[model samples]
Target: MSDDVTAWLLGDQLNPTLDVLADADRVLLIEAHGFADRRPYHAHKLTLVFSAMRHFRDDLRNRGHDVTYLKRDSFGDALGAFLADRPETTLRLMCPASHGAAERLEALVDEHGGHLDLVENECFLTTPADWREWTGEHEPGRTYRQEHWYRHARRETGILMDGDEPIGGEWNYDEYNQETPPEGWRPPETPRFEPDALTRETHEWVTDRFDTWGTDDLDGFAWPTTRADALDALEDFIERRLPAFGRYQDALVAGEPFLAHSLCSPAINLGLLHPMEAIEAVEAAYAERGVDPGAFDPAGDGTGVGGTGDTTATTLAAFGGDESSADTDTTLPPVPLNAAEGFIRQVLGWREFMRHVYRETMPELARANQLDQARDLPPAYWDGETGMTCLSEAVGHVREYGYAHHIERLMVLSNFALLYGADPAELNEWFHLGFVDAYHWVTTPNVVAMGSFGTDVLSSKPYASSGNYVNRMSDYCSDCPYTVSRTTGEGACPFNALYWDFLTENEEFLRGTGRMGLMYSHVDRKDDEEWEAIRERAATVRERAAAGDL
Candidate 1:
């Protein structure tokens, strides 16, 4: 390591413990405003990034590192000024997850007579080599399933594993993770971190300088901006929410936005907290509680040892007495095998899977449009003007907090867009701008390949569904003005007609897809007159959606 070397850190690469920064005593951080002008990003997203960067800079300087923090209009301007002063300076950076970012940064540095070195990004648990070994000469652009990769990761990391078998004797607990909350149930309170003076100043600056989207109210801002705050948030989630997280991970309720969800994605994705930190926390919590994974019977309904629905009582009784009456000191609630496995699968499985998929399939993946959907996203998405309860609730969450759980993103927001035939690229842009957790690597594969079915690289068929799916997974339909049963005519749910219409419109492509045969069977049972009515209703829904009057 040369004394002349300076580490250039991107906004997302805010972790102080990254290996790339260990040898460098000098650092450069740029807060360029030009990129924010490219899209109308959420005020919270902008504030979180900039405030985190500023705080990281202050922290580095406090540790006796030389820090050059630039607030310029563009990276070029900032680099040009830095390089003009120290021509031929050497810079080091972690390879960014966004495609072509490393090459572009190298070019910019080279243009200014500087040498650049790229290092492995330590934010992720797995490496490019891990992906390569997992794929093992598989053809690119083919479907890569998450389950298989998830199993491989667990085996490699020895997470929740007993010898060669999974702890629960199952690779997936998704079937057990879909239960909605019982009546009168309320989720644990969402943890909030009050903004410090520095964050408040950053928020004010962002509101003043940028034409941002989403709610402008700083009172609703709740993301963690520092490593300490992130660690606290992670601990809070592991203690209070992880127990019930898997049971209702997919459930949607009106006016309840953060139901047992970790809310750690913003921190982890921003590098304030590393992925392993979160994963290990959950694993350690499960281990310290002394819950035996072998006690869970995959053949049972997951309510208890033999489907009796008294998992806590059974486990406690096995230890000596009933949990309520036992003399032993009360520990935190035992983490259900379903909950532990489900949350781990997200970080160790799906999150890693999304990153690698986006890496291998970018540029074309950004432009992929296999479904040929070209309609602009409806006004409901932007303005939250729809009478559909699911759409309104999900959009309202995004507008207020730049956040929504995975189910709301997939089942509510993206599901409706896919049913209505909205363009995948436009939807991806909306996700990128609206979510604090969303980066190019996170949103591209989720919105384009999985959500919009723009490509079959990650999924074989679209995640298209009718109001019935929503009605089953959420309570949104109960209070909704539209009828869940009707497929056409007045007051009929827009999703019902649009879903069938989508299938019929893209039948040539969708009918042949895997797992689509069952849906097409229903499609075949409809009479010509019924399809005609569905088409008419779908057309009316599209018209209303476009006009923002739905």
Candidate 2:
């Protein structure tokens, strides 16, 4: 191996990008056991990464690439061992997704190296350098909104562009995507990919080695672990689910885990699907001759977590197949505008925005606690043992699948935590460990910046909500033990009381923030006795949650 060029690949960097493998003679793929061991990473999350890495290694070898594979304690240990054997071999690396991971690799190179070359990661639509160029005048950590950046990206890339003006005379179609599921319509089933022999063995080994939070049953391991499989999943989503995805993007139904959503995030984040390639495919589908794009009044897509107006009723009425449109043909391409636009916004808009914000906030995001929340994350988050049907269902979904939709993450999980004053950093750590698609770059902006408001500058307002919102958006509250309608007395929903308590507690900090004036006005109207009652009830809820009895 003397003087041989080898690319050191991380789990996420599984693609055969030219920078990593086009001219490289050898590749080094490491399974860092110590990395997974330290975090409360879900069993399935571990399985997905490991299985994908193993498969990518096999694929490269089959294509005549010399590959060195190591299942070792840590990245540091793996690099140490590899370098000890081949001191003269040149080690090249793609820049890692996280700042911490990049720093760790740099430290490894300093300790033991012949020559180390850092290559730019090519999985994302925009590079860090591109991000710098995009936000040239603004300093890092400034309060720049995603809508502003999204508009710029639309013009720059010409995605959904019809000349200088956007298609349908607007940049976004989010108004049509935020709706409740139609009463009789059902969502397409999320396709599942079973594990092969290699995946099975690696999964069993991971299940035995680490005490992760999610389900240990390998039979449920159906995530795409190879590039071919990931592509298949993407195609399946476009054909079977994309038509319905926009209408009910935010709605939640009981016993329906993958309702009209593209479950491609894990694959995309893992480099099995390139961002531009995926976005282009979705756009191509929209432009397909047979499909008619749906349209509504043109407006800019609002901040994902804090969309400007209350679109609850209008969106719900529209997507739920309002009595008139129910009979009309939605089957044919002048207009399926909502589905395509909703997806484009998620992929090209929100996804890119999150990464951009992450690049700016990096090392600081790890320690952010803007809300000054001091309480510990409750046991229910890891164990799926909550009494509230919404929380229980969301937690159980995570335990079984290692993932939940954004609505579940934002509304049920983070909303509850925000109400209870759970530490944002602790919640962020939980997000990092628990999901299959979560990496520091993804989770920091999502969980901290969007979900919990742990760190700010992305979302304009806290996404805190009462049970009323859940009742309207989901079916979970229908079977809940607590009454979704009540805010006081016996059998009141915990979220109702907790929501009021949170507003009262954070009123000082929330006073000047733009979207919170009406909420504070509501808080001010509550009598002292009513405020005391809400606080007292919220304390009970927190106490019960702490003891794992709720």
Candidate 3:
């Protein structure tokens, strides 16, 4: 109650020794009403963040820190309630990182008339000022390249290095990661931690308080909340799951949700584990077991995609999770082991680069119309009632698990959504609402910047698709009611026709793009008879979705 009280310790600032918590007195953690109500965020996401925050508060208490956890609907007015109850307290604050958060706290700071320090949230590797310096010089704005930036971070942080040279004789081994599992390949089962009483209590609180936030069937929800459980989950993945992860990382099989995925994103994002430590542990385990250095070895004796070795590193790298956590100066030695490297590239490289782009250009960036797309999202997106076997099955799984792998998300689900002309915003919202680990900072850049960014914010192209693209990547089409080869009428996969129409309609916006050049040539290769039937059927598919028929 004295004048030295620390004002607001935000939910997101869970990392100790960060600017927000350093040398604080009586840290006040707010469980606010207004911010949670600002948008229709998913109910499970609310549960995830809040439950994690409460567990963190208990941890701070156990560490002997004086903390007051408050839930208030009114901002400045609520300050009076705390002030009256504790007359000797002066507000000392570490300002919030979000624009909405900063603006709200600024009001409280002014009203309280005390010393408030705006500090850096050291959760990210690059600060806002660091990104601004790099971005200020480019024109028409250059997209952030994940590998180039990642290499720079590697050098600066001294990760994966051996005497100023990268370990493994290369900076990357993405070439080896792309081999698909042989037909009838069975992925090892993934680890799932059951929810304890604490998680259940948190779920009940979320349901009662934020009832209208968003909806999902929550019966199968088992995510790690405490630091202890998170560590167990990480160890389980390293020992039982990491080896086979590279091969099936992109694979889609019916009734299987966590094929080779670490499923640790929620824990890492919520500040339960550090990226550097997790990556190092994985590398150490592999080395200890003498995992065949060539297990994921991208350079084959001779065979694979484009005759270019194998490009699978993107799959493995994705697990370091997002870089905007309390990451350390540790990296697994460069594996160049195909799938592993590709996976890491996505998580550490592409993921971090997108965060830089989003922070530097959001609000305006969020509104950009890369493809000039405008259409209502289809009913099946929420209803989970689509006639297509793959889509219906995928959506239903997402509804139940609040999780899906990257390939399932970008290539399968988002691919079909784009083919159907589903509104970009709608898809973005749906993903954010349904996924357990979803956060605006993460999902916005992923959906808006990567999946839908025809302007190439993070991607060089829009990731548009035809059914053939799906068929090659997954076995889903094998059991579906439609054929990938059909271009029109009933029994054709809708993706085949809609793909051409999307390219035809957007030719003016996309023709000059080098990637689109290939798709355009493919479209032109279709004979007159084939093209006419496609036009008619594509039109019907669009009309049906627009009218809420399918």
Candidate 4:
């Protein structure tokens, strides 16, 4: 409420943490000029941001502080105007998520001649420095995994810990979380906030200002745009979704877009929800009871529509890995160990680890193309025009809601990107524009390192897969025009040939990897004639995708 200093808040940095909002006299919120125009950003993402910023700004003014918001063509122009309007002001900012962003902000501050102070982002579980400290113990090499980094995070945070040891006697619940939803089992729906005037105005503004890729309508738009609503979403998740979340966390169901996933990423990444608050809320919700294992199945017991199908190991774990079962408990937890540990690993371990990995790799990650993939992102990705049910379902969801479940993201979107040989950087940019939660820090490591393996880091092998993997994990393949069993010729799944061509092209690079041995063995077994058929068909798939004939 004072008029002594100015707090400059980026659109994403909406959290009013005490550190970021320390004794500020006023707040300066600017909508970067032509930001959405740079890429075909989802209109829903823009509305969520603009409406949230307006709400935050209005909240500040309601508390008696002056607020200055400039929706300018350029940030430089906004800052110059602000400097001229208000002299003798020091600009305080929480550090931007990417280095490039920080540099741009810094240059403006330097040119304007006002003192600038930058503090670490409070949204993350840990800072880049903290991540670097954690990595210091392990010698830098090709073998470093997020699991080790995640364990270090758990120990440091003392979350889900019984003194020095983990409470469950195991650090991961990934294996237990992979249950497919039972047929006719209805999943719970995520809460959708009705758009008010601010959101409506922002939607119209976005629509008039730019023509973007995603649907611009506000129907079914229900993301949290205020702190109170964000808290409500968090409570809703813990109370309703968290229980089933751990078990069906990886399941991909048609028409069930959010199933058990928290849907809290938008709020947290935007700074309305803090990481620890969510972590603690979920921990508290856990009905950690001493129960009989026979009576209570901790990990849903693989009870899908078909009594018990063959539990084939898929590569979903590479992105979100798993832990071995513990020796201590014959008894099950009130909340399944998989549910509790899976959520804990994501909030405390994986999210923090991903952010740090992005910071450490940066500009190099932006260009990291270990696979040397140079093909254009297929028009099917943007238009949802393909006959493949999996692509249509996933891409259609992204277009309509600007969202997809993590499994769909990995098994469907990212897996296809890896197999199709799309450029990592361009795909990374597309992800940034497409998703509501995407930021430079979040997208680069996820898209390039984890999703595409552009960086010669994270996994030793790229997250490549065929239609068979998708068929096992989802119903999308079941409804597709192509067959999962067919790897070549007419009506064969594109992923089949693309998956083989990927290995054939990168056989030399993959031969050295220990984990690639299984896939490599399969590659070796194929006769020369089979390889020729695969390569030829793969070429046709790419050509059709490029020409929009598919």
Candidate 5:
């Protein structure tokens, strides 16, 4: 097995049957300190990745692959130092999938004057060029927008489809995705497959290594690190959660973290499961139930489950803001197209678009700064003790579980950080540090594109909003002491003042935006005196945030 003397393996390159593993006598997998040094990544993220890497090493060793798992505790670049002394062509190494890893390895080999073999990691469905073509139209002057490009990707990928046409005669079933769950109606209970001894042991090891690595309080943590566990998690989601996922995708509850969430991103990003197959599993499950994905009501179709009674599959597009009496007895107008469109954009448009953006711009895309907002990350991001209920809960959840649903991510966490003008790098680092599934490839784009960084480009405007927005979307405010209605008064929620302040502060940047028009209209309607009061209140909130009073 001399041909297998040296094969480069990455932590995420977990697929055992990959071509790189072929004929390798001694596989070199690095678990470097530098790799985990980008930011104070969440403890769960560090634990999940390191534990998984260790498990992969063990599995490879058991399978007869001579695995050299380097520990930074004793060895300093053991593989690189070993190769440096050997003849130029004696040792062989494979290229890594990520740009950062690839660059680091290339530098090592070049410095040591050793030979290496680079091969493409054939894991993703779309090539880097495909993402480039989608985003290429907009260059230095214009940036790529998510919706326009996402549709193109949909047509190209043929997911949820017919021949050259979208399934259900529509590219997106977004209209049904609006309408908040009825009050007192609870979402389906999430399936929890508590970790067994393997995960428990991994957690203990991670705990011992990085006892003080993240925010205070890390205990009873559990996330699937091995391939088998990850698959089980995906299957659980497909069976129990996928049916109502689209409907409650944006809903948020104070203590409930997994409301109709797929919870598969960690697995998908970690190479435990492929995106195509994971998404397909959900799609297939829905099909097996004969639930017409196109016609099924995202808002429970008036069924008396998921906390509401049965409703019919009436297209919100046709319904047009007319409140349907099919489900709840409450009489509210049909949900707005604006909200519906925004929700849909996150999934069919933005999510898909970010993938293309990552593929197209990587190494370069990660550095793009549209807003140019630069500041060190605020301390509150790391410390869960921040008095702001929404921020504290959201960050706390991420710290403890390495998880947060989309609503908590976008409307709650991102909104506050942007309003505070937190450094994108800091915000990016915080997300990377805390989330179990967060990686540079995913975290960077989400933070930059869908969240605050995109001014007028991918996002029509900053996703900035006040405490009132959170109050509307979730029950988090009910437990909070601060008043959502207050602007500048004592006990006024920080978000209330900051939201208006953000609009007023960034007026020139946001004035002409179509999305900003309504907000501007409200701002305009406010008398000059009222406007002053709001601005002053906002100033107080910012000052308090700066003073760490919030």
Candidate 6:
């Protein structure tokens, strides 16, 4: 709490209003370059982080605070130079989300003869103590349920809660969140922030100085780099996209990349906007829209129609009185219970749960490979040269923009990798380098655990699936070169054969796991000839994938 203490801010901890900065008038920021050389990160990721850090420094200086900004190759050199003149200076920083970051930073500060104080990171909604209180004792290899933790978070924080129960009388509206968009449906325009002088300069620097992956087109750069722009993006999402976000949250379209998905992850992950700020903004929008929870029937069959009286009428009327009609009506309906609940669950439930799970299960989780599949990732993942429409589109999106919707991440990109028998750790590295929102903490659990089923600590089973799931949830199969109906022989969808082959290959490890009986039942029904054909097709697919000829 000393007034003489200097506050050191990481690139991700760009929020100026944090309590850790209140007592210190002098701020230190370092734009380190050594980390970028460690991997070929996306150009947009480097641009956004450095530009946001520069902007935060200016914002603080303009507010009458003395700031010392350093451009160095490493943090050690930066700290050494900063502490050369002022030895034993106390440097305060928020605890970073990555594992062992605080200890590493503290050790660097000690090496430089400076004192370091780690404060709670306010960018997230939950605390380490909150994670501890919810999960009383950590048992090794025990999986924690996200639903139970989600409810616990709601009860503890009173977010989207009516006294003790959830506001909608249901814990989740996942059933109503799977519908695909109607024919000729177009999503709302994604808001893009035109780069200002600083961003353009930073973009140029990132392009010249680093050998980065992904597209280097500044014209298509849309991520926000300032607090004000992040707020605008948040407002834009709530106003224009949130209404239909739930119904089509899981759907994948041919040309539509940002379908009702909030592009707030990069900004939130960068600390330009706090997680609570987004959750509260969404909660406020739902309250102001005056949606009646009674209109949503929990017993109805997933669809937000027919069982409810006026709800169906109102929803249909908003879309020109036909469920399949593609009329572009400007009149926005009240925010659906499913949309509101779903968005809240993402920020409050799943995001928080991922963080806590990573915190508790790391070191081992980072290297966990329960399935032990060790095939190299296909070249198509890097080059986007696949004939399969789903994988091609998903990888192309990541190659063009450092962004893709959660479904594309889970079902398309990671699902393909999981089915194809790619190593979980290698896939994790690909995600970490390719995405703007991905951090070690974020991608480790998602790609390794949830996506690859490397460990059952986060999920019960692998997210492996054949073309049927993709065909049902998306329109990719309609235009794909491979046939969805055919499981073997020529021009068969790769997912079908790989999926069955994966299940058959790993039945001993997966058959007894949670909720996998149905999948195994299908596995049980295949005869010797069918299995032989599937094995042949799967082998062919792997060979083709490895040769980059698929």
lDDT of each: 0.86, 0.79, 0.65, 0.76, 0.63, 0.86
Candidate 4 segments whose C-alpha is farther than 4 A from its true place:
1-3, 137-143, 287-334
Writing each residue's lDDT as its tens digit, candidate 2 over 303-349 gives: 22113333333333444534334322232211266787778888888
How much RMSD separates candidate 2 from the native structure?
A: 6.5
Better of 2 and 3 by lDDT: 2
Poorest 10 consecutive residues by lDDT, candidate 2? 297-306
Over 4 Å off in model 6, which ranges? 1-3, 290-332
Writing each residue's lDDT as its tens digit, candidate 5 over 1-550 gives: 1232477666666656666667665777677766454445556677677777887787788888877677663223655566655444434444444446666666666667665677666445555567666555546434566656657866786655578875556656665554456555566565554655665676566655564345433453556777777788877665545555666667676666777676777766766666666656544553344334323344434432333332222333334433443443222212222223233344445655665566555655566556666655556666676777888888777767888877788887888888776666667767877788776767777886667664344556678787777887777787788888777677888887777777777788778975788888888887888777777777776677766666
Residue 169 of model 6: what lDDT?
88
Once fitted onto the true fold, the runs of candidate 3 whose alpha carbons sit more than 4 angstroms away are 1-7, 16-22, 35-40, 74-80, 83-100, 112-115, 129-140, 212-218, 290-336, 546-550
Over the stretch 1-550, how does candidate 6's per-residue lDDT look in tens digits? 3347898989888898898888885899999999998888999989999999999999999988899999999999999999997685689889989999999999998988788989998888989998888788887887988999999999999988999988878889898899887666666678989999999999999999999998987877889999999999999888777877877889999998888888899999999999899999888888765355324222233333322333444565543455454243323345777888889999999889999999999889999999897999999988999899999999998988888889999998999899899999999999999888999988998999999989988778888889998999999998999999999998999999999999989989988888999999988888999999999999999999999999
TM-score of 4: 0.90
Q: Candidate 6 — which pairs collide?
A: none
Candidate 3 per-residue C-alpha lDDT over 352-438 given as tens digits, one digit per residue, 9 for 90 to 100: 676676665666666665776667677776667766767777777676667778877887678776766666777777787778777
Enumerate residue pairs that collide in model 1.
Answer: none
Model 1 TM:
0.94
- lDDT, residue 155, model 4: 87
Worst 10 residues of 3 by lDDT: 298-307
Better of 1 and 5 by lDDT: 1
For residue 416, model 6's alpha carbon misses the true position, in angstroms, by 0.9
- The count of residue-pair clashes in candidate 2 stands at 11
**RMSD, every candidate, angstroms:** 3.9, 6.5, 7.5, 6.9, 6.7, 4.8
